[model samples]
Target: MSKIQAKDVNGVRVLILNRPEKRNAIDLEMYTQLTEYLIQGNSDNDIRAFMIQGQADCFTAGNDLTDFLKHTDIDPQHPAFRFLFTLLDITKPIVAAVAGAAVGIGTTLLLHCDLVYADKSAKFQLPFVHLALVPEAASSLLLAQTVGPKKAAELLLLGDSFDAETANKLNLINDILPSDSLFDFALDQATKLASLPPQALQASRRLMRGNIDGIRLQMHAELEEFSTRLKSDEAKTRFHAFLNKKSHKPT
Candidate 1:
């Protein structure tokens, strides 16, 4: 089953994260479906614009860790890595609607999106340090490129979380709206994008970020080192502690 659901709002295609029960954590299957659509959406003439959002309160709780053990790899050959390529390569206007917790990849992924609307209650983080992994999805470069090295280091190295308001002030997110209105507002904005001169919109986007290209191999190299760290005694201890902490938390 696909963790992503698809629908067309006029000529704009909407892709929503469907695993709300798990707080929209990305499993391997979701990655495949998401990447497939990102690649497919751009090439399809019917799709004039695209939007991505979560199913419920949370944007994504990041990758599903237990599920990631067998399939996760930083190698560009890995399908997961290919998924990042699709996201970064999408030339069309991409919008994001973030609710509740936007963890790890959830936060990094927004760096590539064109316009981001977050719920006032939204929380964001890139907690790779806590997991003993380096940021993947070429986020190490992208985050620093967008937010400057000091701020990026503060988030990625410290594994800290931030609120949507703070994210907007920092220009990390475009706007923070009420949770109830987020998806509708994003769709409305998407409709506006769909009504624009498609070629000019695409051309403008390309012009701004055209110089940034080819981070797949770099991500692969970084993750090889990251996976090695994941297997280390230090990371093993931290991972177990996190699991233990979660186990004791109230559900």
Candidate 2:
């Protein structure tokens, strides 16, 4: 079975991350599939909105680093980069149902979403600082814009995980629901979005995404720079230490 499952619910196209055992950590194959799905979904008139969720107790543990180190090319045109760019450009409203660990890209991706419904256990982080790398997904810019520079610096530079309540206080989430009911709540919201005026909805979404072509170009450049730094001695040291500490932590 594919790591990313695409399904159409009413007019909401749902993308569910499938690697429960791995906390839905994204690898190259999953990223490629996600890119294809997003591209196809945009051209599907029947789809009015997009919804993303995860299986089990986690949204994602972030990228599968070892698989990434092995298969990821240094180019900015990687599948992961393509997928992130596609997501940022999508005009349709995106709603995310986040539960459990939303680490790294898991959390940054939500910054692009129009609405987010998080489970009480949800935790978010941008660990690039600790890894001696910079942010991907244009999050360095988007996040600071969303929550202001000081908060963004605290999250990005410190790379510490914060809980759902703190996230809600910062207006990062629409609501925090029990894990069991998160999907239902998000689907309820998506159904409402599906019923709204399409042209108006698209227009509003576009406004929020402002200057996307330009932002997408910037993100590509940012990812290229980040990819180069990912192989640096400092990055390798920090990354390996992270992996070692992570490996010993009982999940």
Candidate 3:
């Protein structure tokens, strides 16, 4: 089955992350596909807006650790980097529907979306520090700007999960809704955006995002540190422990 499913709805392109069994953990292939889809959506005149979502139970559990560990060197050309850069460069309006766990990049990517809606049960986390790594996707800079430096430090440093209420309070998510209703609501909002004047909407979006050149620089810096950290002994030990724990879980 396809891990990333794309569909067009009322000029709104909906990309569904469909690996529910793995909690939609993003692997290398998914990264590549996501980047490709975003690039296509941006250039396609028929596609007015984009909405990214996952299964009702999970938005994403973040990177697939096994696949992530297999890639030693992460450069600008890497699929993960391509995805982040594409997300930053996309001029179209983007909306996100988040539920359950939005961990690591799952949470960070929402920072770039024009609008975000989360379910009451949604949990957002950036546990890069716990894995002996630093934040990626320019989240270190964007999160700080969104929630202030101190709260950003508390979230990134402590690497704890925050509920939807906290996410809304920090202005990370626009609103919280019932799990069953979140996806439809986000899609409705995307349709509304799609109905707007495309040129004006994109212009306004670009204005709101401001100068993303600084964000690009931050992403490059974060990728450099993240790649270096991934090769460290601490990271290896943590990855092994995490995999081992998963292996021991009851089937």
Best model per lDDT? 3
Candidate models: Cα lDDT each:
0.82, 0.86, 0.94
Model 3 C-alpha RMSD vs. true structure (Å) is 0.7
> Which scores higher on TM-score, 2 or 3?
3
**lDDT of model 3 at position 120:** 88
Expressed as tens digits, the lDDT of each residue in 53-150 for candidate 1 is 99657899988776656554446555666677677778788899999889987987888788999988899998888888788777788778778899
Q: Judge candidate 2 at residue 213 and give its lDDT.
A: 74
Residue 145 alpha-carbon offset, candidate 1, angstroms: 2.7
Name the lDDT of candidate 3.
0.94
Q: What are the root-mean-square deviations of the candidates from the true structure over C-alphas? A: 1.9, 1.6, 0.7
Cα displacement (angstroms), candidate 1, residue 219, comes to 3.3
Tens digits of per-residue lDDT for model 3, 36-143? 999998999999999999988899999999998899699988888889999999999999999899999999999999999999889999999999999999999999
| Model 1: residues with Cα > 4 Å off, grouped in runs | 214-218
| Residue pairs clashing, model 1 | none
Ranking by TM-score: 3, 2, 1
Question: What TM-score does candidate 1 reach?
Answer: 0.92
